[model samples]
Every structure is written in structure tokens, then in C-alpha cells.
Target: MELDFSNIKVVGFDADDTLWVNETYFREAEEKFAALLENYETKNKVDQELFKMEMNNLELYGYGIKGFMLSMIESAMELSNNNVPPETITEILNLGKEMITRPVELLQGVEEVLQKLARKYRLIVLTKGDLLDQERKLERSGLTRYFHHVEVLSDKKEENYKNLLDHLEIKTNEFLMIGNSLKSDVLPIMNIGAKAVHVPFHTTWAHEHIAPEEHDNSHLTLNTLSEILKYLE
Candidate 1:
């Protein structure tokens, strides 16, 4: 179905997987870390333990680097039988930092699409992550110039969506959110009567991918970001 975005004045986007590469880098680091831990424990055991720790930490730390670092620390300590050397722990921390500091590689056509959309809509970047890390990514991505506002959110719940809409002084129906995650990017905005377009990424993190039951009533799902141009045109 084509979107009637003629009423849309503010176009909010989810930054991480939507605009650039995010979870794939983290997944690579995780696989490497699992390999390193194989020396201390079976890969299956280590993975199971790490999953538990990550789920627990997500409740406290939410998502992003902090939760990932905590998961790494717990995994290392568990696999080493609580005898993990300071050097090994430092190595893990360094790896986590490197993952965050890695250069941003924008998805194909992201720059061109943003450049085109910026001319027609008020663009805003709404992402959840460590502030400094997100800022570094935006700086490196070279697409930051097109956004009118950049929001670093702790959570992408209904309240956050409402707050952003209120701050922009726009009604929910007047905004459109384009993002990769159905859970974070599409559902919340749709709940508030805003339109949403889902642009599925090739590889989504376990946490970011949501099941069909979570689909928004007022949203459209697409296989690629470029599909949105069809609606806009």
C-alpha cells in the first residue's frame, strides 16, 4: 500500500540499523569473544551463560555498549571460574570499545535517500545508545547534515514517542517514522496514531527483531528502505 505522507511534516528515523550498520558488527565481536572463551568452556555452555547474563543486564542497563560490556564481564568471569586475569578482562573491554569506535558504514543509498528526503521533510534521528558512541557514528557517517534534530533515547517506548511529538509540536498523524526494527521503530509510533514504515535489515540482532504479533495497526512493512521512495514519489 502506498503511504499518504502528505500530512507528514516530521520524519523520524531509527539511527542504528536503519541508517547504518550496527548489529552485525556487534555480532562479529560476540562471535570472536565466544571463540576466545572456548578455551575455558564449551562454546555452547559459554553462549548459554552469556545469553542469560545479557537478558538479566538488559533489565538493568537496557541495550547498547553498557549492557554488552556487562555481559562480556560476566561471561569472562563465569567461563574463567572467577579467575579471569586482569589482562584478559582488559582485552575484552578494549574489544568492546573498538566495536563502538569502529567506522560507520552507511547502508547502500542511505546518503542519497537522506539527501532527497531532507529537501521535502523535517528529518530527525531518534536512536537509543550511549551518547558519545552515537555522536561519533553520526559524525563519521557524513549524513548528519540532513537531520534537523538528533535524539539519543534510553528507550523507544510509547512515552518517548509522545515526548518527541510534543516537543516538535506536531500531532501524531502528522509524523512518519522510518526504521528497521519493528519493535522499537514501528510499534510505538504506530500506537500513537502516527504512520510508520518498516525497512527490514539483512541481519537483525536477536533483541531487535520482533515477532508478527507485535505488528503495528497503523504501519507498513517493507523489505528495503528504498521502497519508501515509492511512497514519497
Candidate 2:
């Protein structure tokens, strides 16, 4: 879809895969986790079971590496029939720490695009996850100077975006969200009368997925963040 952005005053960006390498790390961690518990369960079963644990624990821990780590721990315990060794548990914790501390790798052209967009419109990092971890990654990323605001959402539903727009005093039509998930970044914003550009990441969490037929026709899709410049610039 071709979008006219003359009225887009605020541009929102999702942090994880949209800005940097996130889901890929999680994928790697899951592999390591599955391997750690392989003696107790098959790798495929462990992966399936971990996804279930994550979904069940979403309310309790929200989203982030910490929650994922906890889910892995719980899955390990259950897969092992509660006989998972203490050392293995410790290893799991360390795995999470490694991911949390991993170097931030921004996607191609992300910083350059942000730099350009920041000059013309209000750019904010609109993402959901552990507050401290998000902050840490932003600080480490060195992309902080381009963003006018950095919001960490608990969830990216319509209400959350509405509340944020209200808090920021931004008119619905004047806000534009650019991110990697159609489910979180595109659908809800479009529903709330705002514009969104879905910059799809190769890896998306299953919870954030919807059937292809369910996609609304009103939004625009971009293969890469840099492509946003064509419409916005």
C-alpha cells in the first residue's frame, strides 16, 4: 500500500528484531537450553514444551530474556520430572545472562534511517520487554540520540497505544508506528486510527502471529527499515 505521511508527526519503532538482533539470540538460547535438557526429553519436545511454558507465564513475568529464562527453567524441571540437576539449573541462568549481556547488533541501515527520520519527526522507541534490559540495550546501542522518547510497553494492544498517544498528546492520525510484527505493531495501531508500516522480521514469536488471510488491507509493508525513507522522506 502507498501511504502519505505528510501528517505523521511521531514515528514509533519497535526495539527487538526491528532495531537489533533479538529473536535470533532467543532462538540460539533455546537451542542451548534444549541441548541441556536433552537427556530428559527430546529436543523437539523441549522446544514445544518451552513455548507452552512461556505462554502460561506471560502474565507473571511479562516479556524479556528474564521471563524466557524462567520458562526454560520451569520446562527443564518438568521435562526432567523435577529431577533436573542444580548445576543444569545454574547453567540455564548463566545462559540467560549471556544473552542479556550480548553485544547489540543493529539491523542494516537502522541507525541511518533513525538519524534521517529524527530530523523531521518525533522518533520514539516503542517496544515491550524488561525495562532495565531494554534500557541497557538502548544505552549500548548508541542510537539514543536520535529518539525523542523511549517507551517500554507492557503490551502492544490498542489500549496501550491509545494511552501512549494520549499521554504524549499526539493525534491518532498523526502517529506512525514502524516495526517487525503485524500482530503488535500494525494491527492495533491501524485499529486505533493511526498509521503503521509493518517492517517484517524473519523471526517472529508464534504468539504474535496471525493467519495470512487475517491481515488487514489498510496498512503498508516494508521489507527493510531503510525502505521507510521512500514514503517518509
Candidate 3:
């Protein structure tokens, strides 16, 4: 879908996979965790158990480092007969902290595209993650100056998007959401009568990916963020 930026005011973006490298770090941490748990359970069993814990926690805690840390601790305790060493738990917690504080790596063309778009639109970052972690990444990326508003949300739902639009005093048709996750970024915005552009990332966490049936209307998918430039032109 072509976007005519002549009248568009606000452009919202997802932070993690949309602007920088995120999933790869999480995947690396998960592999290290699996290695640690291998002594107690088989790799496949550990993965399944961890997934189950994460799914359950999503309902209770939603998504973020807090939920992730809880899931890791719970999975370790469950798989190890409640005998997980304190030192090992400390190690995992340290690893999670490291993942959050690691240097930011902006995705290809992200800086360039953001720089270009900032000149024309009121850019806002709407990301869901641990508050401090998300803020740290934005500060480190040096892209914070390009955005007029930064929203670190607990979850990306239709109501959240609607509220953001209301708070900004922008109509649904005047806003466009750009991000990686179809389920979190695209579907919710589309559901509220806004336009969404999905910039597909190479790696996605299991929880981030969505089934095709969920994508219905007012959504466009692109392999690269740079493709947005062509449409806007």
C-alpha cells in the first residue's frame, strides 16, 4: 500500500526487532539456559517446559524482563527437583541483565530511514518491554532525538493503541504503525482503523510471530524498512 505523507502526522514504531537487534540476544540467552538445565532434563523437554511456563506467565505477568526472569527461575526449579543451586540462579539473572544492557545494534537502514522520516513526521516510539531496559536501548541507539514521544508499554493491545492516539490528539486514519510483530504491532493498529506497515525481521521469538489468519486489513508487510521510503515518495 502506498502512503501519502502529505497529511499524515504521527508515525509510531516498535522498538525491539523493528529498530535494532533483539531476538538474537534472547535466543543466545535461552541456549545458555538450556545448556545449564541439560543436567536435569533433556534439551527437548527443557524447551517444552520453558515454553509452557512462558505461556502461563504471559497471562499472569504479561511480557518483559520481569516475566522472563520469573519463567527462568520457575523452569529451573521445576526441572531440577527444586534443587537448583543459588549460584546458578545468580548466573542466569546476571545473564539476563547482560542481555538487557548489551550494546545496541541498529537494523539495516534504520538510522537512515528514521533520520529521513523525522524531518517530515511527528515520530513516536511505542515499544513494550522493561522500562529501564527499553530506555537504555533508546539512549544508547542515539535515535531518541528523532522521536517526539517515547512510550514504553507493558503490552501492545488495541486499547493501548487507541489510548495513545487519543492522548496524542490524532485520528486513527492519521496514524501509521510500523514494526516487526504482526500480532503485536500490525493487527492491533489495523483493528482500530489505522494503517500498519510490518517490516519483517529475520529472527522472531516464538511469542512474537503470528498466524496468517490474524492479518486482515489496512496492513502492509515489507521485507525492509527502506521500502517505506519508496511508497512515501
In terms of TM-score, the best-performing candidate is: 2
Cα displacement (Å) at residue 43, model 2:
0.9
RMSD of each: 1.7, 0.8, 1.6
List where candidate 2 sits over 4 angstroms from the true fold: none
Q: Candidate 1: lDDT of 226?
A: 74
Per-residue lDDT of candidate 2, residues 1-233 (tens digit) = 77788999999999999999999898899999999998988899999999999999999999999999999999999999999999999999999999999999999999889888888999999999999999999999999999889999999999999999999899998999998999999999999999999888898888888998987567888889999999988
Off by over 4 Å in 3: 1-6
Highest lDDT: give the candidate number: 2
Q: Residue 109 CA error for candidate 1 (Å)?
A: 0.6
lDDT of 1 by residue, 1-233 (tens): 65688888888888888999998887787777787777798877877788788888886877787678889898899789898888778878887888877889888778877888889988899999878888888999998899999999888999988987898787898899999888888888888899889888888877776776766345788777777777774
Against the hidden true structure, what lDDT does model 3 obtain?
A: 0.86
**Could you arrange the candidates by TM-score from highest to lowest?**
2, 3, 1
Clashing pairs in model 1, backbone N/Cα/C closer than 3 A: none
Q: 50 in model 1: Cα distance from truth in Å?
A: 1.9
**Local accuracy of candidate 3 as per-residue lDDT tens digits, 79-185:** 99999999889988987888877899999999889889888888999999878888888999999899999998878999998987898898988888999998899
Judged by whole-model lDDT over C-alpha atoms, candidate 1 comes out at: 0.84
